[model samples]
Target: MDECSATKSTSLETLVIQNISNVKELKSKLSEIIKKGKDYEFDVSSCVKTLIKSNDQEIVFLTVEAISELVKCDEKRRTYSQKEIISPILDILQKEITTENAALIKQCFRALGNLCCDCDSSRKIILECGGVPNIINLMKKYFSAHSQLSMYAFKTLLNFAIGGQEFTNAMVDGGVVEMLQMVVIQELEKEEIDEEAVCALLSLLSLINENDTEILYSDEINAGVLKVLTNTADIDVSELCLDILHAQAEHDSVKTLIAKHGGIQVVCSRIEQLMQKFDHGELDADQSDVEAILKQACDLIVIVLTGDEAMHILYNKGLGEVYISMVKWLEHTNYHLITTGVLAIGNFARQDDYCAQMMDDKIYDKLLDLFDVYVSFGVQMQKEHSVLHPIEPGTITKIQHAILSALRNLTVPVANKRIIAAQGRAAPTLLGALLSVEDHHVAYKLLAAIRMLVDGQESVARLLGRHKSALRCVARWGHAGEYAGAAGEAPRLLAWAVKLLTRGPYWHNIVEVDGCISSLVNMLVASHSLMQNEAILALTLLAIETLKNISPSSEHPEFDYEKSFISQLIKSEIGKHVSILVDTNCAKMPVEVAENLLAFLDITSKKNKLALDYKEAKVTESLKKFAESRQDLSEDLKNCITGVIAAISDNGKD
Candidate 1:
């Protein structure tokens, strides 16, 4: 920075150039220049270029060391890359690699690594120079014999891999995947493992997989390696290994293989061990590192236990302690950790045995408590400008989705359903979640959980239906934009609520709820055929209730069935939506829906005014076109269409 310091730096480089013929002095000056941490001065690059071509291996090695240190800066890396020095260094590497010049070869590896640490262009040059195969060869050659060289080679390849897909593909083409797999298998098969080497190799393999899933999907990881590495005492190796397993878990067969090789026991074991350490504050690694390892382990548990076989192995053989440990995530502030714990419990709740076991453990009550905490915390944050802890909204949405989905899965067992409904907290908690949902995915999960809980449990359905705000919430979700998840799932929930409530003593209360009819009418043309049929069934059920209300047994004469309910259905343009469905989606429309639609039209169009409106709108024409377009119409559907047309014409007669 000063003139004297600049002159001193220049004099040092001049001394290197003056003593260029002396290897010992050159090494000393280069080491001194490296320590100075100077950028790429023209004098430095030019002198290093000349010294790199020396046949003396030590000169080449020291020149490379100088290049490595100089390229530590972004501008220097770019400058040296443009100086055309990488090709010469690579040339020397190719020449020395054949001769067992271990020090020079290792230094060349280090230099190449530093050169391409974050430089994509330099990585391209190295790959173009066939650096990958040479590095893979060195890795293969020295993997079993020279651990240090192998590590440098692995780090260099990892640097190349940081360039992403192109460099990763090169490594794969040059047998890098196979080379790393071999390293893992070989090292794991030995009596004593090199934790660092295996961890590095697994890290490389995990990176490659992350960059190219096609390669990872095709890679057949050794079962023995999976078994040993998963159970390895080394946290780093086990963590990296689980990351690969998590990526490969996308393929069900890979999940099966992992389970068959005892992946569940080992993964859960690691989870339990780390959780115990965390609980006792006896973490052996950095807190963040411990959390990362624990997160990866929990991720594997969430994925690998998705299959029935894995679940069977887990609950049947008693991996219950791991589930207990996962439940402890509730006490942590990390949203991801809490979400993963909830997801794993969801996977475990797939079967009756575990659901019952979890119910007995009061896991359901604890999750409900956690949900209440989020709700109360949210309120507190709104009330107070600052709080002791603040959670991101996105993370809060994720936690909500996970908790709702887990509750949904847990209610799948028939016995658990009754107990959950009997517990009295599920309905209100679920309704609160549904009301608080701002994300479509979370709305979908909450609706699905409510739907699952209300499937055959009439008491729960009526419980959810009793809340008018809950009914309105379901209706809003039914039309929640084009997010097919909530939109498609909401109708089923609404239909169940309506069907159950219409049969209960509160039929009058539900029918008066605003937006309920329009929501069902909108669902009549839902892209999901089942949703359309559900709307039809639910509407028909509501129309049947309206007919009952209009009959002699009608108790609530003060409420106008025609103006309040039927007029709302007509105003919602139910017949128009039905016409569109018949005209556009005829061939794809289910026969049951057609029959049910005709039955619903017949029921709702009982009044002469409604029939006249249907006739004027040519709803009959659309129905005939629908009948003509659908050649696969069932006999029941045909009869229903005829009966509906006749009933409409008769009602329309002046």
Candidate 2:
């Protein structure tokens, strides 16, 4: 900065240096300056230029500190481009502007780290300005002597390597991969582990090839990293170590090492101890940070045990921690953290001992509570045009699917139904959630969860009566999905739609009013056996309930709508389809399916006064043909067919 450049901004330089540390307390004053737009950038540049000329360490440090807070948020980051902020920061890192104060050097590095973190352009700018090589050089230089300071530069570089295969290859080319494993190996077993350096290296392996035997998969590296993790005192460091090991868990060698070293026991105990602290009010100093690491610990546990043997170990050692963590996160307000918690539970459920561990447990009640929270979140999603801010969309969805999956697994044991029914809202909440979802993929899993909840629990079915309207959304989805036509989506949908209405007596009115009858009509003749059979059963319920509600001879206007529905049902070709379905047992619809079909036919003939279509069309021969042809048919189905023949004969006699 020349005298002319210096003279033009002396007062601006003074103001920056004076208020740097006090900026947070006088945020409005700083915000007013940022409100200056381009002038703010120019003013900031001029002040830094002048401060650098002074050759004062404290002043430059203050300037770097001020620069940091200026672009602390997205709005500010966007305003200060790489050319203005990063170019200067790069110049400082290259030692063109030198500082003996470690605090100043660290903060200068901190400023660069922040600049690189939030923007895509920062990576290119840093690389273009030779910042990447210098950053790597600085990290390598400070790594052993001043590891805490090195951690800042390493984190910045890690943020750069987050995406773009090109960037990773560039990092590898720059010796970043070699440097990471060595640093991790060297610093891991010391009295106090360099967690930041170790964690940064651990995170980088996720983007690197964990299978490449040259570096990450080497014996020395695995044993060293595994040893540090299994024996580490800090819960957070152990969590990071679990992450690195998880990336390699796919390899048999890694699994053997981790299990032999008691890594599974270590993770379980750490998670249990950390969560107990949370339960006992020990994390009050930093609840959010503790919760965040808790989520990481939970997620790593999910990925670490990649085999049945490992899963068995985790199940035996980690059940109490898994249960406690899931309950804590399910009740947590942070949607992202909750997913990892759910993931931990879901992975545990895959092993019988693990899944069985939760049988008849009280923990599922919180899962039911999560069902309520997600329903509200789903409904809110429909109401808002934008969501998942401050949280990743993938994170939120992964968790939602995890919870549904966990519930499905838990519900596989019959006694778990008591937990769901105990909360009264779990069944209804899931039903209503189905109605509001915009994502068909999540809806698919949620439907499976709902099926499990109400499958054999009559009380759960009865509870669904409370959310009749959203359950009809189930019908709407079935209606739309059936037309998707031979795609996997259609049958998957029809399966749940049938499950929803298998307790049809509880939801018949909303089912009819919401136009589910049209979709159900299509299912009666569907090509899939599952859909066709469930359709027949669902129709039986609808026909029986509709008949019970409205008499065909009634003169009341309200009865006219119901009568019109009967006419529509007949017109929809249900009569013809039912006769055709009963005529064949080659597809092997279950006996209850035939019984329900016969029951539907009997009730329809009794109420509508229409001649039995199958018999009227010469179906007496078709029934005898089918009954004799299929000896493999169940005896109950034989009995149902005999009863159907009797009903038809009685009708003819009249």
Candidate 3:
């Protein structure tokens, strides 16, 4: 009565009951529904419910078969309420699969599989109704008798597993892993194997998180299975086999076996073939083939070769096409392709000319846009605003980590810094990620990129100073993360802060941020050599400003002396900590660090009314060594240390 009320006609349920003995009539009625599916008002699903209970196997099989045709040929699975039909179909499958009704079972599976084909909601309904466990059992039971049943089963599973890693993990949990291993083993044994079966295995393998513990490749010897599969003749077989191997290759032994056993050549060959097909627009049946190869090849080559040996002969093997293909994949809709491709190209960062290659290819400009999109998208998602739909977090993390790493790679070239600075968005976009991204890995990589970008250029450092939020983020994280244990973003971030703190106007904001003083104080005492060195040098700058506050003509300091963080320094125990640092680790410290420490003492001792006693400088053992030793320290350090000691003992000078 809603819209198609005038089209009231014979329900398929009526025909089903009337033609209990007539296969011809039942087939005719069902065929009409299959043809004019929208024209019929028949509760065909109800007829399915009736015939499945009739104990008449032919009627039941015919009824389910008719429903499958209607579902398959139309948009019912996507349009209608799939739950009403899904529950009944699964009920028939669960009960009928155990009986001797092969035709009924096959058509029942076809019905359910067709229903699950087009909609994620329908697939989840099937899963929630315990349909996956049932179908997997049917595949196990009927696999030897008729492989097509298992093929259909796997096709449905493939549909269920399509959208993401979690669903794939669900499939693997529901026994698909063992089912796929068996199918691969069987396909290898047979003279005429089913291509659908191989595709099924590949599709399932695609869902396996490159690091899924639930689908452990080691115990199954899936590497050997995958190695045998790489020589396949079909495009999907080649594409998916390489994808699985690419994921498995994240493990060292698996990567070596795949590479050592000619798998690399097979993968490279498929890439060339697929690229040719894609270029010619000839992938009529192999729709996802080219993108798959790009994804798999990029991931495999990047991880297997560059994963362990980044700056070596592994990349020198004429990977020119591979590199080009990766840059091209940056335009792909799937950011995974873009992400993995970026990571692969990043491996070449250590190579001499690749940075130039990436620039010539306009990779950074593309990455600039990609970085902006990903960072903005990530910010929107984290806020969970009403109008915005969030992308999957795993994918966002992949993209962010890749962008930061690729940007980090670009910064490696001493010359590309100018290119990145020229892009205008590169610095701001990277700075934007620092404020919004939740993942610390991305933050670390972003910090490292910014560090390398501003390493030597005082002009760019001053440019970065205009963004107050960026400065606060850097200073805050640099100070807070200074004590971060293990090798992490702390070293690079602190290094950048060290450079920026004394650079220009950015120095004035330090007093605005409450902990900037003690942050530098703690950074000086940090265990990492780079952090320690940068920290002392940073304090050296601050101490110069402090000296100007005490005595203006004492030195021609460039900083605005009155607004300096000098008072905060007195409260943070600057003199005692510096002496402690010199006493405990002077010899272990770098020569430049030793030099900067001496410079820090030079000014603090020159303070007309010091916070801690100037007498403490005389007792400093490290200073005594630098004063007495013949080790030719930097003239600046020697003079600073000499002045501090001389001031400490003007009475003894006579």
Best by lDDT: 1
Candidate 2 lDDT over 233-343, as tens digits, reads 665566566656766776766766665666655665676677678779875447776766666665556666556565555455554444465556666665545776676
Q: Against the hidden true structure, what lDDT does model 2 obtain?
A: 0.61
TM-score for each of the candidates: 0.82, 0.50, 0.54
Question: How would you encode candidate 1's per-residue C-alpha lDDT over 480-532 as one tens digit per residue?
Answer: 76788887787788787777777655556556777777888888777778888
User: Between which residue pairs do clashes occur in model 3?
Assistant: none
By TM-score: ranked, best first:
1, 3, 2
The worst-scoring run of ten residues by lDDT in candidate 1 lies at 216-225
Note the Cα lDDT for every prediction shown: 0.75, 0.61, 0.64
Error of 2 at 400 (Å): 2.4
Deviating ranges (above 4 Å) for candidate 3: 1-227, 232-301, 307-319, 385-388, 482-506, 549-563, 583-587, 608-654
Candidate 1: give its CA RMSD in angstroms: 4.7
Error of 1 at 32 (Å): 7.3
Error of 1 at 527 (Å): 1.3
Estimate the overall C-alpha local distance difference test score of candidate 1.
Answer: 0.75
Give the per-residue Cα lDDT of candidate 3 at 59.
Answer: 58
Compare candidates 2 and 3 on lDDT and give the better one. Answer: 3
